[model samples]
Target: MGGGPDKEHVLITLFDPEPKDITGELRRRFPHFEVTYVQVSPSRKDAEKAGNEISDDLWKSATILITLFTLPAKPELVPK
Candidate 1:
C-alpha cells in the first residue's frame, strides 16, 4: 500500500506463526491499515535460509523493518 509523506509503512517479523487470536487482535486494533500473513515452510531444511534470503530481498526493495525477534524453542531446538 502506498503511504503519504506523513505516514510510513512498517514491517514486523516474528519467528513463530502468530496465533489466530493474536491475528484477530491485530485486525481489531488496526482496521484502517492492511495486514498480511506469510507462512513459510518450517518442514524444509532450508526454511530459515530461505527466510533470510527473502528478508534480504525485502530490505533491498525498501521495506522498513520495525522489529525482528525469534521465538524460543525446546531444549533441543529441534527443526520441524
Candidate 2:
C-alpha cells in the first residue's frame, strides 16, 4: 500500500443508502484513517438510536463525520 498521512484520523460515516464506493476510494487515498460506517434508515429515530449505541470513546475520538441526516443522540456526544 502507498503511504498516507503522518497521523491517522478517525472518520465516521452514517448514510442511509450506504457509501461502499466512496469508502473504498477514501481508504485507498487515506489508508491511515480509522473509518467506521453504520448504516441506518432514513428516519430520524433509527439514525439517532444507532448513534446512541456507538461507544463514547469513538464519538469522542472522531475527527471527521460524514452524515446525511444522522446525528448523535445528544449534542455533547460530538467532540469539541
Candidate 3:
C-alpha cells in the first residue's frame, strides 16, 4: 500500500480549474497512479453533486488527498 504509482491513488478535491486541470496533468505525468477529480466547492455551489461523485471506496483508497476547503463532516467518512 505504501508502494509507488501502482499503489498510489490521487484524490483531487479542489475548486474549479485545479481539480479538473490537475487531475489531467497528474494522469499525464504519472499514468500508473489512479488520478481523479472531485470538483469540490467553496460551499457556495455544487458541493452535493461533487460529493456524490466520490465514493467511500475511493476515499479509502486515496493515498494522496489534495484539497482546499471541501471536507467531510466526520473524519470517519474519509479515513486514511
Tens digits of per-residue lDDT for model 2 on 1-80? 11134544444555555577987888889777766776766676677777777777767666677776767777777753
| Candidate 3: pairs in clash | none
Q: Score residue 43 of candidate 1 by CA lDDT.
A: 46
The candidate scoring highest on lDDT is 3
**Candidate 2 segments exceeding 4 Å error:** 1-5, 8-10
- Tens-digit lDDT string for candidate 3 (1-80): 54353778877787766545656787889888887676666674666556665787877777778776555555676655
Worst 10 residues of 2 by lDDT: 1-10
Alpha-carbon runs more than 4 Å astray in model 1: 5-10, 39-48, 51-66, 69-80
**Residue 49 of candidate 3: its Cα lDDT?**
59
Question: Ranking under lDDT, best-scoring first?
Answer: 3, 2, 1
TM-score winner: 2
Clash pairs detected, candidate 2: none
Descending-TM-score candidate ranking: 2, 3, 1
Of 1 and 3, the candidate ranking higher by TM-score: 3
lDDT string, candidate 1, 1-80, tens digits? 33444333334444457566876786678665334444444545544553554444343332233334322122122121
Candidate 3: where are CA atoms >4 Å away? 1-5, 17-21, 44-53, 77-79
